[model samples]
Target: MPTVRVTRYVTPLREGGSLPGVVEAEDLGTYVCKFRGAGQGPRVLVAEVIVAGLARLLEIPTPDQVVLDVDPEIARYEADEEVQDLLNASAGLNLGIDFLPGAFGYDPISEPARDLAGRVLWLDALTANVDRSWRNPNLLVWRGVLYAIDHGASLYFHHSWPGGTGDPVRFAAQPYDASEHILRGYAAEARDQDVVLGKRLDDDALRSVLAEVCDDWLEPVPGAEDADALRERYVAFLRARLDGDRGWLPGEGAA
Candidate 1:
């Protein structure tokens, strides 16, 4: 992977969305970063970086995300009052990710749906991702290839955590289907091989990948007081997930 220096923090693209920073990439592409010291905490941006890095390790088609330093003076939220309000409510959210420019759609319930669903199921089990749904599949269809995106809502279990209060929304139960459907026109051999579908996502491999990529991003920022502790917490949480008793792997899902 090539390193891209986030030398400047241009004006944030304050469109209506979850993350705050709308930045200009360095000859790469436009990115929507979670600015550091933004609303909530550095944890949000850090989590995004960690998730994307780990997903790549799991062989998932995830967009590249990285930290970019910007002089606070150059940073300005968009002019829209509602956007600013959203920004104000959530400040210090700059961390950029290249937004792929293209058009794609999911062919669910069709032949290709099985492969797509399998990849998605593996993604959910690995990261414990909970956002994919009938409304927000989060999987994209860019040029006919399935690409995963928007994982900020996963690790934290922002909706329900530390307690089994409600049902786990496995993104429309894509992980539990029996027939294993795929793209209608795909060859039988290809479908039988299940190559487009991923495995359980080796837990040890996942941890190693996370530990490697997150080292730089884990460094404490100048402003955030709890940055170090937060980073450590995230790493430890990931370590536990990779080696814990979650019983989320493949056939282990039935256990």
Candidate 2:
């Protein structure tokens, strides 16, 4: 990911639990910055990087991500106590998604293409993402294009890790519920996409995607030992899910 120094904190986006912010960077670009020190911690950033890479590989539209270098001094000038506190704690590298000006939240009125929706559903199911329901689509519509965002809620298995990674086979066996998914109706189509997209996630492709994750974000876990080990765990988990039974695919005996 490209690195950029945050020059200004534009405003706080309080719609979500973590309270990500819109800010300006050294490259004269605006971004929605996800703080590493947020309540969910760097693990959420790890999900963001990994999923974003997967999205790109599957031809999903998403904003460009950057490694935002935040200065501690910016916190001192923040007027809001809550915002200031967050800035103070996030005085280092944070995750930044290039902000799209005038983007509107996605609604059912303007549905995306069937193939696009299927690919999205496939990606979410593959990652065991539990956050793309109708209640919180986590999608943005900019210039009539649908863009996926806020994947911090996916890959729930990582949250259970005390010092090591979770069981890949267990995650692979877990069934995904598409009843409330934004693209729930496209489950059948997604299954077709599953066959095609699944084949694309070979070792080299997964490695390229995993390479985008920052080492700092891969916090050391007990059995994992270090960031590289942790990354390998993630790769293994994903590969297991891909190569394991396709029962997790929506409409394929999935809930």
Candidate 3:
């Protein structure tokens, strides 16, 4: 990912728990920056990079991401006490998503095409993402194109960490509850998309996707000795999900 220095502290986007913000970077570009110091920590950032890469591979539309270098000094000029504390805490590298001006929240009333919706559902299932419900769809309609966003909630296994990393097979066997998914009706198409997209997510492809994640965010847990180990763990988990008996695919037998 390209690195950009944050030039100015902009307003806070108070939509979610993490409290991501809109900011201006040295490249004269505006971004929605997700801070490392947020409640979810760097793990969420790691999920964002991995999922974004997978989205691109699946031909899903998404905003560009960059590594934002935040300076501690920028916090001094902040007027809001809450925003000031957040900026001060996030004094290092953060994840910056290219701001999509005027993009509106997704309206399920006018759903996406079957194939596109299928692909989105497939991607979410493959990653064990549980956030894309009707209550809070992490999708945006930008200029008539559906774009996936806020993927930090995907890959839930990582939250369990050291203990969870030990069993990739278990995660592979895990079933995704797509009944609540926004695009649940497109299950048949999702199954078809799985057959196609699944083949593309081979070992090499999975490695390439994992490569986009920053080393710092791949912090070693108790089970994983180093960043490389952690990367391998992620790859193994994904590959298992793709190659194993995919009961996780939402449909007739889906949970």
What C-alpha lDDT values do all the predictions have? 0.49, 0.89, 0.89
**Per-prediction count of colliding residue pairs?**
23, 2, 0
Alpha-carbon runs more than 4 Å astray in model 2: 252-255
Candidate 2 clash pair list: 163-221, 163-222
lDDT tens per residue, model 3, 103-173? 99999899697899889999999998899998988999999899999999999889889554778899899
Whose TM-score is greatest here? Answer: 2
TM-score of 3: 0.96
lDDT of 2 by residue, 1-255 (tens): 899999999999999999899999999999999999897899999999999999998999999999999997998888899999899888889999999999999997776898998888899988988898889999899998999998888888899887567679998888888888888888877987787898888988988888888888888777797887888888888999999988788994333
lDDT of 1 by residue, 202-223 (tens): 4455455455333444444333
TM-scores for candidates 1 onward, in order: 0.59, 0.97, 0.96
| Error in Å for residue 186 of model 2 | 0.6
Comparing 1 with 2 on TM-score, the higher-scoring candidate is: 2
Q: Which stretches of candidate 1 lie over 4 Å from their true place?
A: 1-21, 37-39, 75-77, 81-93, 105-116, 157-208, 211-236, 244-246, 249-255
Which candidate do you rate higher for lDDT, 1 or 3?
A: 3
**Candidate 2 vs 3: which has more lDDT:** 3
> Judged by lDDT, which candidate is best?
3
